[model samples]
Target: MISKNVNSLIKVSILSSLSIFSAPLFATEKTIPELVDAVNGTLDTESREAGKKVKLRNHAKGFCTSGVFKPSAKINNALAIPLFNQAEIGVIARFSLGGTNPHASDKGAGRFMSLKIDGNNESLNFVTTNSQVFFASDIDDFFTFQTKVKQGAEGKQWLIDNKPDAKAFFEHIDQMLPSSSFANSAYFGVNSFLFNTYDNQITAGRWIFEPVEEKSTLSQVQLAHLTDDFLKEELLTRIKAKPAMWNVYIKFAEEGDSIDDPTILWPESRQHLLVGEVIINGSRDDEAATLQCEKSIFNPVQLPKGIAPSADPILNARAPAYIESFIRRL
Candidate 1:
């Protein structure tokens, strides 16, 4: 019999993965501003009856407001040079709550940060969260995780069996997801890009970013309201006061290493090396210019050298999804 702890973890992993759904499969060729207009327009049309509670707690700063997801404008070329080795690139980050419910609050319990880093030659996109392990393995599983949650277990297996790589991925699901979340689970690109690195073949991976701060659960009493600009107010307050640093690292899969399997786990025994620290000095854009900085996209596959992506199907799906979404939105 499975232990209660393990069973709980399994539920969290699967549930979370499903909630982080809706990848752009096929997007139209639209400009970024046009995309934004449409997306925001759709958001306005959403049914927001119950006031959504979004809590954001920074060091010293108390929780407040639903973090607003806005358009990124500035491209910090100088910072990119040191970290990604790219001279210049365009990027955008769309922040949102992970769920199918259109009425999800901007300040939901969990949040997602999608970054698109444009390389001089290529680009990379990363979608990450506070939790380490994802609910689903790939885009399809992403949907399956949701179906099972809404439909049932038998329904999930049925969908998987119909897919070509079903058995292999399904067999790996047990190992891919722990009954509970990893002491802290993480996300990698799980796909590869063309790089000078030899292992770039048949291998793809995702990047993981952990908060230097420890996890101390916040209760309803800890929650507060900051209106809409909660994230901006909090993040800015922290940066304005002291230099906030986050360790950034990569975890990769090797050639012929199930590049298509999004759930495949790369060993931490191969611990991700520290690339660098992201120091948020101040706004990379001026007040009037903040608009441009917000519109840019920060994709993951946008590698320079030593860093690259794997040739995974997940990568294939993301390539078009992000580009089209960005093209239309940006």
Candidate 2:
């Protein structure tokens, strides 16, 4: 989405930072700042394309809701995090479409569920998406893909031609139908994390919020009749009548499973445990809360304790990128 003018500006900005990317090409040793720059550049390009005020780099169109997280009995044995040990935790969540344009049509766009579990001393966040696997596995690959996308159709075609995984991911996204409500769709966490038990046994796992409600999808006729901003309205009306819920499941990683590469999915046969449940009761009324949800970056790396991030380069690179994106809007 970069115009020639923005493209030239970015080239000038990154000229001095070439070495930062060069040294990390193979090792996936991308620094936080470098990743931040890459993310901000993409956001700038996207904002210019949208012809709108600066907003989130992605998932810009979303709504915030207040809720409570009830820990399942299984959670105590699964992870050693004290936050989860609590009976209930105050939670704030945002459901959004996957795009830089805040006012774009929601149809066919990817969805995101970002949740923050507020605890006494520390807070945990899960920035989940409606996909089992991501497009890129490492920082270098993600950066390259972002760069390619900025080049427009030809650059995306390069990915389809050369990168099989990226090709498959794009195909998956293309086939995804629009859900009638956010409450009906499942949300998957792309990155894997280590669940350290109090007994000192560590297990690698990823999480998914499986909807407690029946799944619903929009028919072609219905989709044709609805407006672009129907989702927020539907969700707001739905929540007023009844809360939406999801059962949290931790998919345990088996031996030989790819722990670091988020682009790879673990076998369906892998054991999964129901560790908790999320109940979004109502939309936030406070303007400050709304603004915070809209503006603040939900950094997944911000952990409480007992849980640790895997060696996934893409996972580690997210925080810095999100921080940069957050800073640019302010």
Candidate 3:
């Protein structure tokens, strides 16, 4: 559970970045209640009594958070092959749903994948979702979304009750490749960067990962029986069967781009670059030492070299809170 003091700092830091928040619809305290119970009206999950009691498992790569190790892990330099630079890098990739249940799968829930690339002298992190954009840009909207709805409720009813511009965002993903199918879709870092590249202080981009096997888009019904550990099993299957590979690519955005607005899209076809790859050999899948690599902590803040978080507000928020929440379990 990273730390309360650090989390408080994160919340305060998010508050200071108000100009970057895009929720004009719920800008006032009268419209959207201030001091929301993120416990979702149980009004006590934020308190130490229940909060401290929550159980979390730590990973070698990341700490405990929300009671699970999650799709969390800290990658090391030995695992990464640099694209732009000559040095090897490490990366953090996190995946999870927003629901309260630790057992919930990617079944019907909203899933997010955040990547923290540790390169020479800096870090580059890409926080993404199954949908194109995010539920909110700044921390306020994020807290509001967390407080307003109970996860895994009636999806439509929940949408109507709390009208997030999330619909518009999903519509973008649907329209972009309506028939193409991201069933095996790769992701991009839609925000701009302020990396360690002095020659180019501003780097706006996207990151993509291509799976070795061809599979259809997994459905909720199928996922219900599978669970989040599905990825673990799927990878294990590959190890028992053969090798599996995923290419990690980054697409840089143009200068002055709005990494702050989670809603806006960086024109991918116009400005983006493919950065690198992560190839997983079958060798480590069954080994205990292999699993040990997962226990190391990985945060965007844990930059090693020429990569740094962009000016994107979400990037800023994730930097501290992610590592803090992680330390709880690690």
The top-ranked prediction according to TM-score is 2
Total backbone collisions, model 1:
56
Ranking by TM-score: 2, 3, 1
lDDT of 2 by residue, 1-330 (tens): 346686466545544444354354347666554564454444355544443244436676788877889989777765688888788887888998876667978676477899888788888899999888698987777877766776779988999998877897989887888888888899999899999876889999998899999887787888999999988888878888999999999899999999999999898899998888999886444546544676566879888888899988888777755654544544
Distance from true position, residue 199, model 2, in Å?
Answer: 2.7
Question: Candidate 3: where are CA atoms >4 Å away?
Answer: 1-42, 45-48, 56-98, 109-127, 151-164, 169-185, 196-201, 212-215, 219-229, 282-297, 327-330
Alpha-carbon TM-score of each model against the true structure: 0.51, 0.85, 0.61
lDDT of 3 by residue, 142-205 (tens): 5655565545356535654565565555455444421112224454444444443434343444
* lDDT, candidate 2, at 87: 86
lDDT of 1 by residue, 150-211 (tens): 45577557656665344454454444321111112233344434333332332234566554
TM-score of model 1 relative to the true fold? Answer: 0.51
Worst 10-residue lDDT window, candidate 2: 47-56
> RMSD, model 3, all Cα superposed?
8.7
Rank candidates by lDDT, best first. 2, 3, 1
Model 1 RMSD to the real structure? 14.4
Judge candidate 2 against the unseen true structure and give its global Cα lDDT, from 0 to 1: 0.78
- The top-ranked prediction according to lDDT is 2
Model 2 TM-score, all chains together: 0.85
Ten residues in sequence with the least summed lDDT for candidate 3: 63-72
